[model samples]
Target chain A: MTQKDKSILMIGCFDTKEENFNFLRQCIVSHGESVIAMNTGIFGSTSLFPVELESDLVAAEAGESIGDLRKRADRGHAVEIMGKGAGKLVSRLLTERKIKAVIGMGGGGGTYISLAAMEPLPIGFPKLCISTLASKDVTRQVGMKDILLMPSVVDVAGLNRISRLIMRNAAAALTGMAKVNLKTDEKSLGTIAISMFGNTTACVNECTKLLEAKGYEVMAFHANGLGGNAMETLIREDCFVGILDITTTELA
Target chain B: MTQKDKSILMIGCFDTKEENFNFLRQCIVSHGESVIAMNTGIFGSTSLFPVELESDLVAAEAGESIGDLRKRADRGHAVEIMGKGAGKLVSRLLTERKIKAVIGMGGGGGTYISLAAMEPLPIGFPKLCISTLASKDVTRQVGMKDILLMPSVVDVAGLNRISRLIMRNAAAALTGMAKVNLKTDEKSLGTIAISMFGNTTACVNECTKLLEAKGYEVMAFHANGLGGNAMETLIREDCFVGILDITTTELA
Candidate 1:
């Protein structure tokens, strides 16, 4: 699917990452792509850019009011509140097929909010996070999602040369990943998803050859966590007609 | 309180990260700390170093056999199987106080296995992962746990200068962290936990001054996710007599 068909949802804490988000949006837009900005910043009501979904709207989506959040005003609580709001908003966008990819950039607070929003998207939807916490242990920020995190060499404090280079590269790469079209053969063949590994390589190869000979398509899943998770996601989407389970070791 | 009182639990896929783990073990040992090595590798039956807990034992802990896994031979499946096994083993060790820190070093498979083991650890226990995927998106590898990840700049294919430097730094840091003994004043003052943020800084400062005047020890939780989670954990462990939740933002 082309990115032109779907807008990239850029989520960030506008209060903290206003400059980063603006630069990132410009980068994405420069690549012939459109953007939908969400203000996930907890401390502010207004943003430098036109934020379509304000933090207050996001908070309301999470069953809270930004006004109430400000009244409370604890950084940790703000993160939780804004994170929930943004997450709910992103989930709704995913369901409505309005977004092809989600790009989030932030410091600790921004990273927490952005990643939380993108964590619920299924595989194949491009999810990218450019953050200060990119190099830190983000096991909780990513969970089991295919969220791609590009480490910002420096802190997301100012628009330094290093930060700009990293952010630019990440934006281009993600936009390319989101929009790239894979050429498909016009011929229709019933596709099959086959799970394989090095030990079972020969067996899978022979099966694939035999399947191809009979006008059937074969897709191999390496059985790694990413491969396994992706295969399941594709299967759930009804993208594959049959499955040849050669190795079920992960089940062990 | 002392490295002599606790041993770091070192877990890795011996088949993939045998050399790295062995080196890591040596570094920690050089710092006068001991290591409990668990081979979480799936491909091999033995390791380059003496592995205290074998992959067979780990698999069995997850209700499977390494022999069966070898015959089936799926790398992805092996990772999942060993991850579960290692996770179970590590959890038990943590509960039994057999380990003060869990150190895992590996490439993709090894990192996966090691991180899976360390994920179940609570807040206070020091958890570290030295991995090739350290710079990559490690959100899944770290989860919500307090695991620290050190990026091995180069691949863990050999004992190169870069890898050695990183491994050494990570080892020394973790050891120092583990062995640090904060000098006690021996003064009996009841401790209080205060959750604060920039917005509540003035209020918290006043409160801290008043509490200290009343001869109460006050510790402030900045109300970031880490700080808030830590405060909750310390509270759960009965580490505080009173809690001043001035900023309730995280509750949103």
Candidate 2:
């Protein structure tokens, strides 16, 4: 494989579900890309590339049991903190440049944990998640980044026919996206960012039209919680010239 | 006080709590504001403001049953739709430009519904909510808009000491925000928007430095879910020239 074959980083709880992990690994390798799988579950087998950072380690790493963590009654907060730690570890790995894409599979908790890990990546970096709750309102989970959610028709407990099909499609999607070289031209016309909601459609529409008429390119994001975050992410990347925040509905 | 001074738009469930309704009405009038309160609950109030746009009226207008609309499983989704209907009615009042600000009091469902109504107003509009759940995580309720949240310290069951204090502060905040004559200046410098999260702090910092050094003004919004949405609102208003969204963390 040439240097053009991108390295895809797959992060998830790979320990208990060996079939899914192996299937995803085989798929990534088959596509002629490098795979660096990070296992975040406390009970999972030793990760292929084990997270060495002390902060990335879960409470179980300090010999505390899951039951002990639960007894604190702030289990969700504890999990979130740990997810942030793991995210830092993932961020360090992403800075290395070899990891071009990221994909994860999980239920609700795992989805949260994986997203926390992927949140540090820049816009246009491929990110995907296959989860049972993908069909539901994942506005909170998927926020604003370019993370694609693939609904796992079957629970990711074991690799069955349904799981295999969903995982395969997700893998294919990531592989395709990873292979495609996104053209990032600095010389293009500057971009303008805009936010809109269903209620303020008229105002934003008029504003966007007026701006575009003036030779500015307008990128309107739904001012849902995540849409807002996505626009902000692009702003940090120097992607837009000015913002027209018409519908602050979500914020209100 | 003149009738113009008493023009206030009051929103809440006035069905079960007649005393609360009377209390809010008295509060509105005492502060030299006219009350145009809309009753969202099932029961009618003989003493307080009449239901200008009844829920059944809204249902008839939309060609849907009030019962069917109320049957939505997610209370949040239900409130969102109701808020839309309320927003339409309020917009008409706002057309007269008499509604200097909006003040609301409620629980989780009420706050959600009220925000939906208040969200369509442009930024700098005076919006206040006195909510029992205000002290909790209100990111979802307030989103990116600048809605002031005053914790009802006491449950909004009746007008008690704590309730009085909370409501007074809310009223005062809205009145002050609305009454202030804010000077507006046309933004001359090109605006740049950026999203930041703790994990991607380095990227945003470097990018912001780069943009500001190039003679652009930078507006950095935390890429938490709502911060992203707020930035989008500004974008739709034609506020920013470019966006550098490095900390696209919340999108995951």
Candidate 3:
């Protein structure tokens, strides 16, 4: 891949799921997209493909050496440190705008690291995680992020009939999202955030109609724990011009 | 409420949400359902209505006194202790068949305690959490439990136009679920668990069709994190007679 070409950031434990990631990379390439591979596997490296960012650097980012981590031989602790490292590194990559999107495939450890790596990306950044744990509750890991979790449908061990199809689809989806033009007119009077629930839906609808008529864009967030958290986070980031906290139930 | 009537277990911080809970209690009563209220509020008790289980008893369940917890003044610690107590108490109630369903409404602390308290309940058991955090990612707290989280479009502080409508709906829904007669035929060729993903949908569908034709019940689980965990959990409970595991991608 040339330096001038915008790339998809593919992160995973190359030491284990090398074949699956390779297949995913090929699928993306077949769709005329480039990939920047980052390894989060703590044990070792893979010979299948060239990795732009290795596990050593990831470990280093967590303020630990790969040798020390291996010497400790504590899987849980190691995974945690690696996840922190991956998150830090991914954040830097994001800040530099070196990648247009991010994708990862993993089982338990891999999924944890992949999610941690994508934590720094903003909402609608086209982050995808194809994992065995996809069907499991990942609310904590996903938080309020707009990360898309896809069920691998089978173990991402090797390229099989089922694995191949899923990986290809995941690749296609990522490439399509990365290449899409997301330009929208910022000509509205202002953006408003509204808290709403089923009971207040009618009220919110009326308010929204009037606000839109006045040339403002309105976003409604469910007063559920996650929805309220997201809205608050966005509001803190100064994304809203005004607030219509109709259903402040979350505060209770 | 009559002793002969199976009651809905209502859990919340009664000291804070007395009005809301009382309103909810009335709604349930209006629906011909009895409610057993349990308080998890640390500071004080409510005199508005009868509380079947008080915060002192809940705190005692965790091997601590409410006075000591109050003196400590650590909100997080108190919440954690109360949650554990509530969970233990709820588990005991379930074992004794004292309640048919569980419902709670709260903000952050209340939601946390309610979720923790309902942790010991089994899946298919009616459990509802009307919380501000409902819209938030609560996977970690919910784990593999089948808890229905309803977003409190407004805060649970007091009765308002939106809060009243939402709370009433919550109460009605809880009562309806508690009174539901869930009966299914246990007779079948056997139960089979199948893991599937979008890529392997066709194959799984064909297998399921053939299995039904053979008088066997086929259950499919998505290979995502949550889905895979739920399937494995149910399988461990000996809910299945055989396994298809077509899309075992979650294992990856």
Best by TM-score: 3
Cα lDDT tens digits, model 3, A1-252, are 323366888999898788888888887788677788989888898888779999999999999999998899998888899889999988888667677778988988899888888877754455678776664566677665556555564466766434564565566556645654131111222478888888899999999889989977777777866678767766665667899998978878
Candidate 1 lDDT by residue in tens digits, B78-161: 889999999999878766667766788877888898888876665435556776566456654565444555545345654643
Which residues of candidate 2, in runs, are more than 4 Å off? Answer: A1-252, B1-6, B50-53, B57-80, B181-190, B197-215, B224-226, B236-238
**Candidate topping DockQ:** 1
TM-score pick, better of 1 and 3? 3
Give the chain A TM-score for each candidate. 0.75, 0.75, 0.88
lDDT of 2 by residue, B1-252 (tens): 222453667777666655665776775566566667776553344455565556655443334556776665555555655676777767766665557667777877777777777766554455667665553455555555545455453346655433443354345444444434131112222577778878877887788778768877676666756557767776775666787877777879
CAPRI-style grade of the A/B interface in model 3:
incorrect
Residues B153-216, candidate 3: write the lDDT tens digits.
Answer: 4467666434554555455445544544232111122477788899899999999889979977
**How good is the docking of model 1, by CAPRI class?**
incorrect
What lDDT is reached at residue B60 by model 2?
39
Query: Which residue runs of candidate 3 sit more than 4 Å off their true CA positions?
Result: A1-4, A181-190, A198-210, B1-252
What are the clash counts of all predictions, listed in order?
9, 52, 37
- Give the lDDT of residue A151 in candidate 3: 55
